[model samples]
Structures are given as structure tokens and as C-alpha cells.
Target chain A: METRNLTCINCPMGCQLTVVTDGGEVVSVTGNTCPRGEIYARKEVTHPTRIVTSTVSVSGGVIPVVSVKTASDIPKESIQAVMDAVSGVCVNAPVSIGDVLLENIAGTGAALVATKNVAAKQL
Target chain B: MNKAGLSYYDIVIIGGGPAGLAAAISAKESGADSILVLERDRELGGILNQCIHNGFGLHTFKEELTGPEYAARFISRFHELGIDCRLNTMVLDLKAEAPSGDEGSSNGCIKTITYSSRSEGLVQITAGAVILAMGCRERPRGALNTPGYRPAGIYTAGTAQRLVNIEGCMPGRRVVILGSGDIGLIMARRMTLEGAKVLAVAEVMPYSGGLKRNIVQCLDDYGIPLLLSHTVTEIKGKERVEAVVISEVDENRRPVPGTEKEYECDTLLLSVGLLPENELSRGAGVGISPVTSGPVVSESLETSVPGVFACGNVLHVHDLVDYVSEEAAAAGKRAAEYIKGGASAGSDTPCVPVKTGNGVRYTVPSYIHPDKAGERITLRFRVGDVYRDCAICVYLNDSRIARKKARILAPGEMQEVILSGDELRSFPDLTEIKVCIEAN
Candidate 1:
């Protein structure tokens, strides 16, 4: 059995969880207080993905640009490639909230969208 | 035409989070004839809803509970007390209605609060006191200036937490967490358990910023590597997150040369820090502490503005929800007193601002009025870094007012030292207060 120590971040308890795995599958899980910990552990041993948030350059804005984020989750390994595609891209000012930056970015099924609007920079 | 306008309440709290909810309950219990709570979210519970893990309510409830459970305990009590809570309602603005003392009151103080709701369309209410409890927001990726091609797989820990716990969505397959705060450590274990390989939890600090228990349980137990004094210096990806360059930092927190290591991963989670949500507080003209980024309160938890009180994470970031509830209870009790005209009499003697000294990061209850009889001052603050066998000394100029020995101290955790009203009486002519950590 492969014993793994896990940290429970679901709350501040930060409980150390011990997950015992057999044959590359979770055999028994211990040391988690909430179901989220067990879920976290099981997923850690399996699949994981992350939500991405970043900023895009906006021409003619007061703050130089505004912040943006992926409205949906994306593949874990594809984040670097996705961010690279977003790096060179610049949106014009007057972008509205929820405006799409990139639809189906890198074919990851996650759309990069604007979280806030930067009105065209005043001369 | 006798047009009946919206009725006014004794107190109106915005943001229905722990701070707002606790303030409402305290206002009612303190004899505020009417109180209202406006929450923008669909439900009353704030960020607590997404926090499904336990370790809450130990101090206030004397039992361990999850985030929802802790919030539920207060929410249920709020309902039991018949506090008016309007969910799915957003407060747009707070305006001073009139000058103090013009309306036959000793001080002319009135607030006009505008709000909107699906059921009520547009509505306005007036109140004598307003409490700002909007809480704080997480630091995002750009704030760190992490050199990288813009990437897809980076997320704030809170966002990922919400997606996983509330929406039942996976965030990534192979995860690497930045800044070993509690969230990142927890997520390291969380993603790992969900069948994701957490490459490492990298922190720039020499010592782990998260709780000691987290280091043991989250990273050590899971065999997830914790690279201390290291940081993700660069993000390498063309279209998505491919790999990251991790580098070690010296004591000054500057990256060292020739120690760069590369880790291939698809995702990065940032749990760097939390900043107090002070936009509404600033708009309301409340004095904010530069260090804590929350309101500067006296012993009674009353903000610089009279009748305005704050509590919970809105007041300052608390390490535990139990402490939040406890602090909120105090704010609530004080708000109730203020409404009942029972607040501590104003002091003619100028209040002295407390400063943090060696080994201390910051101190709360920024000012103390010695004349405020019956007030027990609880000073909450944090240390600079990890320490062993240290003593926390509260000093008035050169004279020490209070001192306590601590077995261990961590900057990630807040510490509290309570001074009873009787004890404060001894230092009546206080000019200054200082909290310092010294070797035990």
C-alpha cells in the first residue's frame, strides 16, 4: 500500500491526511475531516485541472489594461500554451464585462473573458 | 397625500458575511429596535459556503465544524433572533442624509442606503448607523508579476476551491501551488487526492507561512514536495501552462543565481495573500489601518466614525472562523450598546496609536481610551516570522503593561492578548502602547 500524506485545506484545520493506496488505486483514506478532503485526495491520485486568471493589454485605457480570466476550467498541462496565446493578444478599449478574449482557447474548451471593463483612455 | 416611504432601521449592515451577520445579531441584542442585513449573494453565507473543510468553531462553539456549519450556527441564531436579512440584494451606496444635531438629536447623524433586489426593484432605507463588513479579496496572478507567457492553468486558490467544492469541477491534472499559505497547502493535498499529481508547493519565505499542521498533513503526508524559500520565477508555455522555473530566494527574498529548477506542470495555484475589501469602508469614510488594512477600532470595536462598527474578516483577516464569530459578537454587542445610547463616553484625552515593534508585524485595537470603563481590550496581532519560546510584551512607553510567554509563534497565525478593564486602569495616562516579541 502506498501511503500518502495530505493537507486538508478545505478549512483552516489543515489536517494532515493519510491516504493508503493499493495497485495505483485508493484503497483506504484516513485523516480528513470533511468529504472535500477525501475528494481532494482521490483526485490528487487521479486527475486535476485549474481555473486561469490573467490580464490582457487594452489599448487606450487608464490602467494600461484590465484583468481577465478564463470563464471555465481548462486542462492542467495546457495552461502555459494557453497563456502564451493570450500574451500577444491585445483588445481595444471599451471592452464590456464578460466579453470573450479567446473562444475555445487552444481548443481547451475554456473561454478567456474580461472581468472588468476599461473605458477608452481619455486624451 | 400622505406618502408612506420606506421605514428606517436603527442599524443597517452591508455584505451579510460573517462580519455583517454578526454585527446584525449584536445590534439587535443590544436593543437596536430595528436592524437590516443586505447580502448581494443569493444566500446569506459568504465565502464560508465554498469552504467544506473543518477546523472552525473551536473557540466560539467549543466544537470543530466545517465552514458552512460554523456560518450556519450564526445564521440560525440570527434567524432565531428575527434579524431582517435580505439575500440577493445589493447595496449601491451609503450617503449622509443630514448634518448632526439639526434633527433634534445631539449629533446629526443619518444614513441613506440605496439597494436593489429582484423582488423590490429599487428601494432605499435610512439608518442611524452603518457597518461595513464586505471582507477581503485574494491577490491575483498579475499582482505577483510572475514572469511568464500569459497562461491558462493558473488560478487563485479560492476560485479553484469553489469550483471543486461547490461546482464539482476538477481544476487540473498535474498541479503546482505557489505561496505555501494554508490554501495552497490544502489544495496541494486536495488535487493530489483527486488523482492529480501536485508537483510542489513553493514558498518564497524561509519558513512556511501556513500552519505547522498543514506542512505535516498536506505536503508531507501526501509526499508532495514543499520547496521553501523558493518561488516560481517564470512561466513557460506557448498556448497553455507547460512548465515553470522555480528558483530559491535569499534571506532578503531576492532570487538567488544558478539555483533554478524546472518543473513540468499544467496548472499553477496562487495563494499569496488576502487584502481587506475596503472599497465600501473607504467610501464610508472610515479610518483604515495601514498595517491591518481594516478599520482601526477602539476597545469597543467601534470604528473612527461613531456608531459604525466592524468585525470578522472585514475588520481584519482572522486565522479561524471561531475567532471571527467571537470578534463579531463583540462588535454586535457594541453596536447594540451604541444604538441604546450606552456606548462608552467620549474621551477628551487624545487616544494614542499603538505601534508594532521588533518581531511583531502589526497590532489591532489600534487605539485605546482608558476612560472607556467596563471595556476589556483584546489585542490581536501577528509576529514577523516563526519563533520558539518567545514572550509577547505589551509596553506603555518604557513601562510594561502586560507580558505573556508563548511556546511557539508563526506569522501565518494571529495572536491575541486580552487586557481587562481593571488592568487597563493602571495605565490611565497612557501615551503609547507597543507589542514586542522577545526571546523567552
Candidate 2:
């Protein structure tokens, strides 16, 4: 059995969570303020994931770049691969906020979509 | 319009960031017709445009949203209201109209603002009420007075954020962050995600100035070392930042002689602190709080200058954008009420000053008029240091009025207490109101 200490990120309250895992399975979770914290702790101890956010260069856009983020949380370990794939890809201008730039990025099953609108530069 | 070709607005908000946008929306909703927002940037949304990270709008919208998404919600609402605004307009100065009486210009009945843009040359405008929402700016390397030659590699965390997220440019590959402020911690993760190596983050204080969640996700998740009680002692380079000397800091925050260690790096990111950008407030003759470095306000979010209100970072640095929006919306509603000739300071009621003691640094709306406050008033303040298992106590004179248990209180997180107006009214003979922290 192993114990892990974590801070709950579900809210700004940042409740400190203590979890005990047995054979790679969450046995007990304590020190959480709410049920959401318990669920977060169980997943966090077993498989940690994060939503990767970054910017992609845009050709012929008003601004040089448009911000992008994965459609869903990807495995923490695949963050680098997702970033590497997104960095090498650039889309043309007139991109909307929800435009998907890369589908199934790094095989994480999460599409990378633009978070900001980049209007086309007037000629 | 005055002889200076001044246009007129019922409410003129100084910034178009989250604060200003929320303020304008509330002001218009409260029945103020002639509302105008002045944005210095080419577009709206202010700094949120460059902040692409999530974890925002959780409090306000009850869901996680990226910075731009959160900002776009307000922008769309602002447009829906048909509120007028000037983009790419930079405000130059704020001036009081000088009410003729010894009562002082604190209740600046009429105020003038000067701004300039490409399409419009320098222009002046008069407002019935002004909401200062200019927000705060990050402290640069010059503010630290670190011994170093001006190099090409050093950048404030915020400036670097704009470069990476907006301009799509990288500041450097190998990085040594000077402080563990939220922006610095976020940048530590950002640079690494962008394929740059973040060497380490050094904080002068014993405790991190950022949120505990950020410390875990941004640094610990990425295996970045956070050196607490440490600061950059010297910058070693001629043309660019070749290296920096990190030294452990004593309790006095002074560098220890033998604790100096060198790290080879090409870039340095400073996130020491944020100061409320209150130059315009000072120019308008608003009373400034030495502790907050922001305007001294009343319970209604009205500044010393009555009709002129302040909120967001211009009043005091807020840790969350949701709080900024919340505070600013109150400022907007109050400004609209003030414009309607309601809640005028001409009443005979005296403004009661709320005193701070024992670990509390300062409180916004330092003064309160008991009757003017609605059902309850929320007083927000920051602690001077890290505290654990303490109670936030509110006192009416020497008597304990309220006590709430606090699990943790840190300088990085803001603390707030709600004072019931009915309770204050019950103590009609109350002489002093104080807030302090006590060991539980």
C-alpha cells in the first residue's frame, strides 16, 4: 500500500487530498472537501491527465498566431507529443475560434482547436 | 460638450479588460444609456486575448474556460447591449472638475478624461461617473534592483506571455525563472510545453506566491524544481543572459553569502509582483492606500472621489478574474445609481473606517457607511504571511462580532469577510470595527 498527497484543482479552494492506493487501485481517499474532490483524487492517483493549450502560427492572418487547445484532457505523458505535432502544423488565415487544426492529435483522441479568432489580413 | 471639444458620457470606464467589460454591461443593464469603454489595444478582451490557458470562468460561469473564451462571453454581451466603445484608444490623463466647496473634490461630480487613437486625434470627454478598471501590471526586472547589466534575454513573465501566446515567438530555450508568481509558474509549464527547457524557478520568499494547484500542475507535473527561499543574486553576461547566480535568502530576504549557486541560461523571466496601475487614479486626486497601492474605496466601491468609482486591480490586485468581474459589476451598478442622483454622499451620515490588525495587510473599501450598505458588505484583504488553522475574527469595537475558521491563509490568496448591515445597525453606538486573524 502507498499513500499520495495531492491538491484538488476542481476549484480555487484547493483542498488538500490524501489518497491510499493498493496494487495500483485507489483504496481510500480522504482530506477532500467534497465529492468532486474524491472523484478527482481517484482519477489523479490512477491516471493523471491535462488539457494542453498553446498557439499555432497562422498564414495571412491579422495576427501572427491563433491560440489552440486540445478538445479534451490527454494523458500527461503525451503532452510533449501533442505539442510537437501542433507546433509543426500551421493553418491558413480566417480561422474561427473553434476551428479544428489537428484531428486526434498524437493519437490522444483529442483534436486541437483554435481558441481565438484570426481574421484574414486585408490586402 | 465643453469648449475643448469634449463629448459626454453618463459612464466612462477606463479599461476594456474583464473588469471594464463587466462594469459597462452592468451599468447599461442598470439603465445607464450613455456608457463608453476605452480600450488601449487594437481589439477588446485586453490581456485575456493572450492568456490561452483554461481554469478561468469556473466561479462566474460554473465551468472551466480558456482566457479568450471567458473574455469572448463578456465581449459578446457588451456588444449585445449596444454599449459604445472606442478601440485602440489610449487614455492619457484623468482630471477632476473641482467642485466648489470645502467638502473636497472627493465626490468628483463631473470628471474629464483625455485619450488618443489613430482615427481620432487627442480627444476629451466628460463623464457623470468614471469607473477605473485599468487593472495592474507585472513587476519588471528593474523593480527588483538585482545587480545585472541590461541584457537582451530578460523579460517580465507577462511580456513573455504575450510574445509566446500572441506573437507566436519563443523568448528562449533554457530558462531560469526568478519568482514563483502565478504567471511565472504558468510560464514555466508553457515554455516546457513549447519544447524549451525550464531549468528552475527561484522564489525569494519561503512560500510560493502562486496557487497550490498551480505549483502541483505547472511545476511538479513537469518535474521542474521550485527553489523556495532562493532568488537570483546576480546576472552574469555582457550581451545576453549567459548565466544567473541563485542564492538562498534569509528571513530578512537578504542573500546569504555562501549559498550562491550558478545556472547557465539564455533567458530570465521575472514575476516578482504586480502593482495596481493607479496613475490615473492619483491624477484624479483619489486617496491611495499605501498598503494596497490602489484607491481607497467605500462599501459601494466608490472611491474617495464620490461619483468616481474604482474596481478590479486598479482598486487592489485580485488573485482571480472572477473576483475582478464581481467587484467591477458592483462598481458599475453603483456608478449608474450615482448618476441617477441616488446614494449621493451629501447625506449627513459619517463614513466609518474599518481597522486592520494581526496578519491582515489591508482591506478594500477601507471605509463604510453602515446605512448605505445593502444586506451585507464583503470586505476583501490579503494576509501578510502564511498562516494555518487560524480564525478570521471581526470585532465591533472591543466585542467580537463574528468569527470564521480558516484552514489556511497565505499571502498569495485573498481573504474576504462579510459584515451584515443589520448587525452593524444593531450596534448603533459602535465606535470601532476591526478585522484580524487569531489562532484557532
- Per-candidate interface DockQ score: 0.04, 0.75
Q: What would the per-residue lDDT of candidate 2 be over residues B257-371, giving only the tens digit for each residue? A: 9999999999999989999999999998999999999999899998877688999988898888999999999999999988887777654776678999899999987988887
Clashes by residue pair, model 2? B106-B305, B106-B306, B107-B306
TM-score of predicted model 2? 0.97
Candidate 1 local lDDT, B1-440, one digit each (tens): 01126668878888887778777777777777688899998767698766655555766777555566567677888999998988899888766544643763423466677889999988988877777778788899989988878879899999987766555467889888999887787777667655689998889998788876667656775678889899989999978899988999999988899999998999989999888987777776778988779988887787876777788887888877667767877777777777777664265645767778889887778887766736577889988788777899988878887779876687888898887766666765777888899888
Off by over 4 Å in 1: A1-123, B1-6, B96-107, B344-350, B373-375
lDDT of 1 by residue, A6-70 (tens): 66555544556788989888898787767988987787665545555455677776445545566
- Per-residue error at A33 for model 1, in Å? 25
Docking class of 2: medium
State which candidate has the highest DockQ. 2
Candidate 2 ranges with C-alpha deviation above 4 Å? B2-5, B99-108
